[model samples]
Target: MSSIFESIEHAQAQLKELAPNQWNAFQQFNELVFKEGALSVKEKEIIAVAVTHITQCSRSTDFHTKAAKKAGASLKELVEAAFVATAIKAGGGVTHGTHVHNAKKTDASDFLYARSNLQNLKSIGKNAHEGFKGYTQFNAAATTEGMLNTKLKEIIAVAVGIATQCPYCIDVHTKKAENLGATNEELAEAIMVSSVVAAGSSFTHIAKMIQSYND
Candidate 1:
């Protein structure tokens, strides 16, 4: 009987044989995206680890966790990156509550189309809204000048938003990153980093499934 652990190698070999061109292209793209550019290779790998966690890519989590370590990211820095993703994911839900609070008097359909009515949140849920403000401040503090600067943290935020498929977050962080002097090239590279990690996650998980089935 085959072991699940051995299937990853087998699946990769089969993929390369079945679609050599596509496989090669993907490999090339991955190599290109991780190269040092607007963002350093170390910074890119740190962002990759964050995106992997947000995408919940177990395989990628393993890969990037090691890559980040190799790139000289300390364990504290890695933990901070993970928390940035956590903060954004939680904040997305909380911010959306503005729409919900505003729609209380309207029909349910109105809630679906409601934009962020933050003012309404202030009026309707003062305490909770204050808590939201506190969270926003915390998020700002977390991403500011520290082991990771604001610009890089915002780049990481944009990548996380893209991986999580949160438009609000993408808009917010992309603009914030720009304001903090992140060039278009840097932004594009950050997004590309996310794309590769997300795609890699899918391939690796499928490999895991194949391994299980063969076992």
Candidate 2:
């Protein structure tokens, strides 16, 4: 039986063949994103690893994991990055759940995202309350300092938020990261890293497209 996932070794020639200009452009952008600046290549790769987890792209995960290891990321550091992704992903659900309360309010503004919306979580259904508490514990544990520092974890969270495209998370974690002393340059690099990896998740699947066409 053929596997759905294409190996890392699979050629992307078919994709490049179909759109050489766009593919080449993406390559250039990807190269620039990984270049050392405020964040080292290793730091960028670790962010890519976290974004892959959020995107649930095995190809990106494999690619970034190896790149991270090659850049001297320890197993512990990579795992720490992954857990940050986990916390960010779970955070989206909890933050969005506030919509349930906002939906019931007759006076609620047309605006979808607001700091006030977070208040609704306190009124979340009892059935979900315990689960929410469990998530809170896990998120705290995952985000607190371990192999990675709190500032780096928050930076990873910012990147995952962008990858996951959660406005609340982007807003919340960006602030958290800033408060934790993450610089403008650092956050900018984090966003670019997220962008490339998110695109790469789709880019890697071109192999599957090639396989399907042949079969």
Candidate 3:
């Protein structure tokens, strides 16, 4: 397998080139965030680690497992993240299981009585047209050209999935990105960016809680 990192020195080197003022600002931000936010960077890293586990992103699980440790996250935090992810996945499994259980009592012809419904679903193999008749349109104003492409968009989706702890989105985006030929390295970087963004969002929650507490 590829190294968890190409090398640690490389990651530190990239960190060095950031604008000093910006880096300082964000570091100060994350410091307060670590203490007062709904989640610490440690917690965010823990969640990201669990997401990688369930999504089966081998490189990501490996990298974030170490990152969680380096961030001072505890085993409890990691376990919590896993529980949340599993809950979401198990909920989905229950829904699918119900359909399978009903299959025994329901005839296929009756279950899908409408020919059109069956055709549309069965045609998924040959046609995505009906399957994606109104797929979510990207915001033209928010995302620019390079970001809107398939590979890059999948990268962004994976980032969002990790940061948001959304298992289904994680599964979709990981598969899509791989199908589009995204390298393991690029996906890892995208996820790192997402982790920082998620950490920042925790600060928003902290502010809200502080405001409420003060009031």
Candidate 4:
């Protein structure tokens, strides 16, 4: 058996040979997304690093971390971004705990995601107050102003929430980010960064696919 963790570069040449036009288009789009816009290149790379964690794309994490550093992001900023990802990802489950209370044999529409569902968390708080309290405290600490401001952290959270596909997180964090004065352009950029990184995560796995085919 061979290691599944093969280098993406090895497969890139193959991909280009197989689909030169699509590969070139992807390259251009990726470059454009990482280039300066509403967010700095540093900010976009940091967002990439943060999102790679939730996507669990080790290769993307390594690549984006280097890109972020090259773009002048400090180690502290990267770590802070990562923590924001952590908090947002974990928060999805915690917030979704509300569904447990309303579970039943019904249509999906019956359980539509309303922000009001978050109020059901009070029950979890009453039943598992200590654990719930602890998690909330950690979430607060992770997202609070530190090396990164609340706004940037919220933006990073939005990106992670998108990658994680956590509608609850998206709703909460986007509003929080807006309250912190994150512009629409900044939010759009964050959404696109998440979108591209998620796509890149799958793209880099072509190395594994190539290996499997050979095996």
Regions of model 2 farther than 4 Å from truth? 1-11, 125-128
lDDT of each: 0.80, 0.89, 0.50, 0.88
What overall lDDT, based on C-alpha atoms, would model 3 receive against the true structure?
Answer: 0.50
lDDT by residue for model 4 (43-137), tens: 99999999999989888888899999999999999999999998888899898888887784255337468878888899989999999998999
Would you list the rank order by lDDT, best first? 2, 4, 1, 3
Question: Can you write out model 3's per-residue Cα lDDT over 37-153, one digit (the tens) per residue?
Answer: 333456456546655645555545666778778888666555555544454443333223333333555454454323233233333324545323322221222122331344554
Residue 210 miss distance in model 3 (angstroms) = 2.3
Order the numbered candidates by TM-score, best leading. Answer: 4, 2, 1, 3
lDDT of 1 by residue, 1-215 (tens): 23543568788787788778988898998999999898888899999999988889666887888998999998878888887888778767765666655556654444443445544546534766677677878787767677777788898999998888877778788999999999999999999999999999887876666667766
C-alpha root-mean-square deviation, candidate 1: 3.3
List clashing residue pairs in candidate 3: none
Error of 4 at 163 (Å): 0.9
> Where does model 3 exceed 4 Å of error?
1-132, 136-147
Cα error, candidate 3, residue 110 (Å) = 26
- Candidate 2 whole-model C-alpha lDDT, 0 to 1: 0.89
Off by over 4 Å in 4: 1-6, 104-109
